[model samples]
Target: MSEIVFRSRFDNGRRKAFERSPKVSLTSPDFYFSHCFGVCRKKTSMGPPGIIWVASRVTQPDKLSEERFCEWYEGQHIDEVTALSGVPAAARYEAVPMSELAGPPTAETIKAAEQRPDYLMGGKWLTIYEMKDVDFRHTAEFKSLDGQSKPKGNLLDEIFTKAHFETRFGALLSNDDKGIKKGPGKLIISATMTPGSRASAEDIEQFYEREHVAEIAKCPGYVRTRRFRWVDTTVLKEFERLPADPIEPGNSVVALHEFEGPYFPMEGLLKADETPWTARVLESLKKNGIEAGFYRLKRVYGEWLPGSSKL
Candidate 1:
């Protein structure tokens, strides 16, 4: 049997809610077989088939106030995008600051906080648009929103000049729907990564389906976890050209975990990952690295209905 330690950046400041205790090893072959077999029961398809995830940081706040920026985003931009055929829903989120937490800071937490960008630490805002399929990008309605087609002096143009954006398109891989709560949780953990050369996509998928998601589910307030594989965005870039320089490409995979929260359940989450399987998976992906952030839901836009402008 292999001994693999569980370590997380959230483990530093010990809060009663975030503490972990050791558990009996389940690394034996029999346990692995039975656990994997039982947990891998058949299910419906993953999550939404296609999604557009955009994270933004306001670089020139003097030129555009956050209030005005959000007003245009929620009031106008979301309406424009969701009105297109095959696009049904969207939501917005804001990054949560570490200083707002009640506990003392841990070294790891401090380091993580320090690494965040000064503009907003993690991204200041995130918007997610759900599509019926990845092919929605090729539709004429979508193409009409291209840079060449936008009015010269639109609010969107001003937004582009004042904000930096990172966008990703994801195709669903798997979803643990059994644990999902009634509505979107107040907090979301967005984790992006690429599997290292040592691991295959199947390895990552199986690990989440069999162990990782279930473990996280054990934590208090855990809502659901959805995983996605990155879709190439070369074409999207050609369509929606903005004022800012192009952003670097995103990671190959993303996992979104929703949690009901007053604050992040760091202790429960750290303890949840205390398994040999988690250690093994993390080690495999270590070479590629993981980027994760905490964001709180600011607002949610339900499915777009025909002939309705309501967001």
Candidate 2:
């Protein structure tokens, strides 16, 4: 087998940190098998290489009004993070209620819509941050800007006390652009899961690449599909005061399907999953390890213009 070597460059300070960290050969089968979902293969059309930080939260509305939370998060917090080096862009999303996802009231559609885990269902807001590299989070600039070590009494400190946050880090695997319009889709459906003991990471990647993604692309408003393999989980220094019980284990894989529309065609999504191959793969995922959510883009920050709010 041909060997593919992975190399990286960093400044002196970062080099020291990188050297101290555990090393893994990117060319090894074990490395590819463990961290990637077949995107490492030469045949695969890989997405823009980098790390994505997905952060979701549910804030106490009674203590801090929704208006206040949105004003602070959208107006202040997002800009602060994006201004940092290595962080290029960010987007925010709001959960779409089940009632608004118009489609046939069939059993299948209803079941599919309601099959999300509690964390996803309860996380009313989500933010996706695009980083230039995986080590960006560990840099001294990030740590200082994070303000975790700073004294309390700031607005962020107050907001953290009133909200429950969950975050996961994933490396980009594949980005399939199928939408007519450029940038992010108005609607996004996120599915996350861990493969069963009998199934391997490659098995799930092949399913999406060969079958599932194509099926969904045939839907009316299909825009693009992006896949990621989980890397790790972290608690923002702000949320450290809260109990850790709410922090859930991260899933092994995540597939995001973006759509352009006033409303997603729930019926079409159900039909796409009716194939026997999809059924077999889904069944092989560990029990209670799968979760999904439907969200509408709310705001765009940094490099991209703001998305439509009409959804």
Residue 256 lDDT (model 2): 80
Clashes of 1: 2
| lDDT of all predictions | 0.58, 0.61
TM-score of candidate 2 to 2 decimals: 0.72
Per-residue accuracy of model 1 over 119-190 as CA lDDT, tens digit each: 232467877777777545544455455231333355344665566555666777766655546556778888
TM-score of each: 0.69, 0.72
Best by TM-score: 2
Give the candidate number with the greatest lDDT: 2
Residue 98 shift from truth in candidate 2, angstroms = 0.7
Q: Scored by Cα lDDT, where does model 1 land?
A: 0.58
